[model samples]
Target: MFRLLIDADSFPLGKGPMVMLILFLISTIFIFARSEEQGQKLEFWIFANTHFEEYQTRVPIFEAENPGVNVQLINFGGTMHDKLLAAMLSNFGAPDLVEVEITSIGRFLKGAIDEVGFVDLRPRLESEGWMEKLVVSRFTPWSYRGRIYGIPHDLHPVVLLYRDDLFKAAGVEMTEVETWDDFIAAGKKATRDLDGDGTVDQHAIVLDRRTESDYFSLLLQQGGGFFDEEGNVIIDSELAIETLEFFVSLFNEHKIATPVYGTWHGDPSNFAAMQDGKILSILAPDWYVGILKSQVPQMAGKWKAISMPAWKPGDRRTTTRGGTMIGITTQCKNPDRAWELLKFTYFDRGGLVNRYETTRIIPPLKSAWDAPIFKEPDLYLGGQPLGELFIELAPDLPPRYQNPYWSEGADLLNDAIFAAVTEKQTSREALTELAAKVRALIAKDQGRWRDL
Candidate 1:
């Protein structure tokens, strides 16, 4: 045992005895560490390989504030979708907190899984006033029939990334290309045989044939979707047919766009196309900036972003694409503690600022827009303030919904897009077949939503 002794050399020197002070500090630190070690451990499963470093940096701050709680940030690499589905189906091994991407969350939002799978957060949202703090549109993707299951982590507003050097060389001005027709004309002019190879060596745009960004981004920008407000299948609508025709015409008719080999990441063809200067522009979201920086650093400072060219003069210029949301599962034992961690990680002012500053992720919280981090100029985009552009485009985005059959629908649509663009079938014919197949699926899966 340690004995407490009082030193009288200078009546404790007005600072207490040195040994006692040192022991007190040590005991306080020990108690704090022990409390944190014995805290309620909440498991958080995340699938973002790119943003993991930034997340690791913020986890400790949350743990420090909530001394009785510890969060385990587990990264499941690229197979999170399959793993999550398996867990939800088997009703076991589900994490307390799970980050679901926009492309895959539709499965969790519909069907039997959605009925008893996750916690409905609307009550907590109303009590905490989080609805006003966050962008309402960001939550739309994670919302099911009359329920919100998750909180969005960021707003992924789409933008047109163009090479200024290529644009200047092609004699195309962004301001002059306001509509899709103008963009098509510019594309035709931009495609050229720069090296005198007797073949058009450079095209105006490159698109991912697999992911069908043209269908999702452009269709949404034109206020069209695969489904309507009442969850009806409408992929064969006039707007969708026209959008499909226009997207295909860029490659088949104008010969201004190149079809890349794969979707989004690890596609050597896309990487080579960008490096060889084979395209003038690519329509992508703000998150693609990070991909460009990490995957093709050589092209830094040569690219700039602009609002998406409108379908018509007064049409919406931009629409959102990809994002991730954190949902609390019904498997969560300590929901109150999990909510505390979620609030600190996402809604906390300091965490939001740090995330934006470090990762360039546009937070969904409206209050975060006022931070000085949003005003910082990006060096990769020729000193363009990309945040301001996203902020401007985020609010006007048209509402979008994903049905339970979106995964199947996306697959069928990708096939339809491939068929139409490859000249195997007409756009209308392919989409009509697609709509038929999707309607059959919706009917077979559940008899009620087959009215399309």
Candidate 2:
């Protein structure tokens, strides 16, 4: 066995050169896997692909506090939804703890978890008095058939993320975009090049909202309402049609986001493209900035955020985007241990780790917002108190109209958006097709669409 003897002065003088040479040789192949599982096998499931490091710092703390419990974390990168669906069909998909995206929670609740493998978290929340503190409105997407099925973790509301330095260089007034019309105008002005370069140095904006007139749902503040109360697809409405035409106008008329840039070929994250400096402004969510800061640490203080653009002069300036739900599996052998992790992840330790320390997740607890840590100006946001602005917009969020059809509906919408943005089909024609497809999907699936 080899060990270290701490010698204050002579140790460094004797071992410094040797340590440096050893570090150089070992650095290339250094392998540090997560702590190994202990005696009891406890599986913890989450949809963490990029933020694995955040979980690293929490593991030792949790394991030390609660002995005799082993932890296993399952990460599903791009195939999370598809894999879960397959596992559900076989009755073998139950994880001790699972994280579901709120946007697609309706599908999991209706077909996979509600009457099947997942247990209701409401009882635990009520017994612990966490229900009152959690953001109720943030979790409406997970509610199906009038039952609370999931708990909120972080919410991604579409907002304005802009380059302030560019705005200043262009001599453009930086303020809240009054309406979509004004936003489109701002995109045109912001999409300019300086330094007399023949090629454009920066673009005006990038709108990555890909879905079947789905931007219509966000624009209309509806969750792509493919089925009505009577369960019939209503894509033929004038409001829906207007939504389609407006997306096309973004390319044909305004020329803000390029057809190629608006095209959905890869991830829509503002974090990915912001570093390349392709676009100057984007309509993004609150947590998006956090993702940027963590992944591309270089672009730390160059960005700022604003509320989503309004449809008209005085319309509401908010729309929902991303959020997460943590649930306990019915197959869990150690729910108490799982609950500890869930509670600690969402409610304990001053909410910094969940909101800040653990990466870019926004704490779902309302009280966390008012805390001194969250109230201060952040260096990443150019010393602006972005948390205050985010909380101010929280109450203004419209209740999400989520249903089982949301996931497939998102797929259909993605197709339509791609076709229109890439000029494979006109916006009107693509949305018309999307509306027709969604009607058929609803008719075949459960829900009131059967009668309609």
Candidate 3:
């Protein structure tokens, strides 16, 4: 403390001051070198308009545990897709990690971009037996050319969310509904005009006419999707045509269901229908639970979630719908650390528990289901253990072929559905027409598309 500064003019030896200065510089460099080695840095970017805020709460735990790692979270929200596309096109500015929506993921999986854009996670994933741990079909949507590119954020297993009160009023017991035929009969019984108006006020179920969402849900459940295992279009197959016909019958022949033209589940009229007991049930995925809770809060305790009714008495009881996949981009500067962050967010049991507890987005990891939170009864579903039901249905999910042309293909299918239901075209007629249109579209870009 006497004198911290060294005076070169007053130094005893000629080289003493120079040696001391060098020593000080070396010490400073050593400290900085050690500091940098200890603090590994990672940069992450997510979609701007998405609800992944829980990551903000949970990432601190990851950083704290890693000690020398710093993960910088950048949220692009609304323009994330455009930015990500630009970054990929230029081969710059892409994030180490990204959250890609299921519908939009097909775009990223096509052509040269897929080869250079996203890392193949299979090597690391297989080492840990990651596929065996989660439902195997959960990998289907994120897979392209037999390579797994992303980890599933949630299973989004489809469930039939129904009004138990309405089921009771219709004299239909949940256990009694074993097959789709039984479901249709119950719907017929449930639908009636309470006020004796010419128009029936109540319907057994609701579907979207402008969208193939409900049709897609059921079609996937029936093991018929837009593409087959070999990447060939199979949407016009016998099973696919049959599934479409069944959906059409619900409205025209059975008269037990009604169609909404736009965003059916999110529509105000649909919410009012749910509130007024006009629509007793909806064919939706697990994420739709939060939508119901927020959009139709008064519906609490009156609803229940059950595995979707099977097409046959003992077929697979459920299928997957909407979900997101978190992937590691090939442009990652620190892929090892990036994988660590991704594994923690998606595959780690504790992280999954925290994710479900905070955001209520169910995890794809099966071990996470053992947590007490998953076991607790949801009061929103009349104390039914909906989590347990979702877990039970996870294993049986059919593999979905999400091809590059899926976006355009889905539109064609929706148009086909519209024709089948509204225009009263036979399922075969609608699908045959759809197949021709899809075939032509695919022929234009033969490499990116598969033949029907």
Candidate 4:
């Protein structure tokens, strides 16, 4: 009984119109059904392009394995943490998962642990035996009040990257340089005035007077840090004072290290210095290998890695530096699914292998250390099985703790280092002042959080 009208004309409904309507109905149903099949869409945010690319390759596999789930990766670069923080504060438009750099993680943990913007993954980590599988110390930077909030991405163990050719030519036997004393003695021999000028041209090491990383590395190597295991401010600890004095003495007293030109990583000037043989060695973490390979590819086979010299024999020769963690936001509606994706990306063996191959970054997963990819010789480092060396040093890496004011504390420590190194203040005086300032900041933070 249906009819159709056009302008002033009217006609009985035809089979063609009926067929068209039927097809439209079928197409609408099919569209919605396909949409339903697409299911949960997870928004993941990352700051690093390398990390983003790694996830892009794995997302398709995850989608195929998990029906009805899709992942959208967004790389916000340097603004990622700022945007994530704003979303967390405003409770709007947040990604289900995000990568938090170690330095930025402290800001998110300022509040009570239960109220943090990221989900507390401690239960899942313990229930699934992830705690045992991954290196425990790596979790420290991503945890607060004993509750872990993120999965560690890398081990980042520090090692000595030295010019093997230079050392051999200088007759400095690296094998005998097991302690800092021996290293200092060898460094004196390696330091030379290559151009016959009164000023020294080649130095044993590169120390950045402006940056905090090298200082932190040496401090952590000696079991000293800004805070104790109990989270108390210990910037002025006797151990820390000694470490600062020693760090300063490297350039001021020993005169064996050259001031870093720009930065030890990623800077063209530093790469040029290395290429020109102006510096003999650098304290590098696992991640630095990629930088060296990519930036100074011509240095292949000329450089080598060795365990860092200990303060004394029998001490830990490795220290941890920079790191990253992947975490699910508290705003995630389906934390279970997000957790699955997180585990797949960071914890799964296949995913870890893909990540290692892509980044050359040693995974915090202890079991993944034995992968064949890790055993393969690196031609860049004189065919050394660099991953194997990192694995040997992994268990001994010192733990680095996190506090809400960590960034501020680090800045203050840098200022203290500059003061002492420039003779504006003695190391003890500078560190003592720094400890007081850090304590005051911690107290202020406690009061603000208590109010919240």
* Residues 17-84, model 1: lDDT tens digits: 67577789999999879655432888888899755666688789888877767788889978987898
Q: List the global CA lDDT of all models.
A: 0.81, 0.65, 0.81, 0.87
Q: Lowest-lDDT window of 10 residues in candidate 4?
A: 3-12
The candidate scoring highest on TM-score is: 4
Q: Which ten residues in a row have the lowest lDDT in candidate 1?
A: 3-12
lDDT (tens digit, per residue) of candidate 3 on 131-172: 788877888898888788888888888888888887888788
Candidate closest to the true structure, highest lDDT: 4
Candidate 4 achieves a global lDDT of 0.87
Q: After best superposition, candidate 2 residue 169: deviation in angstroms?
A: 2.4
TM-score of each candidate? 0.87, 0.76, 0.87, 0.90
Clashing pairs in 4: none
Tens digits of per-residue lDDT for model 2, 1-452: 76655543465556777677667767644532221232255666667664445555566677777776666677876567667666666777467777777655666655543454566776777888886786666656665555556677675556677888886677665575677777777777877655578756666676654653236435446333444433356655666667767876776677666432434412454445666676777655666666666667787788877776777666777776667777776767667777888787667646444545445455667767766655678778788777767776666666565676777766887777778777788767877888888776665664653432
Better of 1 and 2 by lDDT: 1
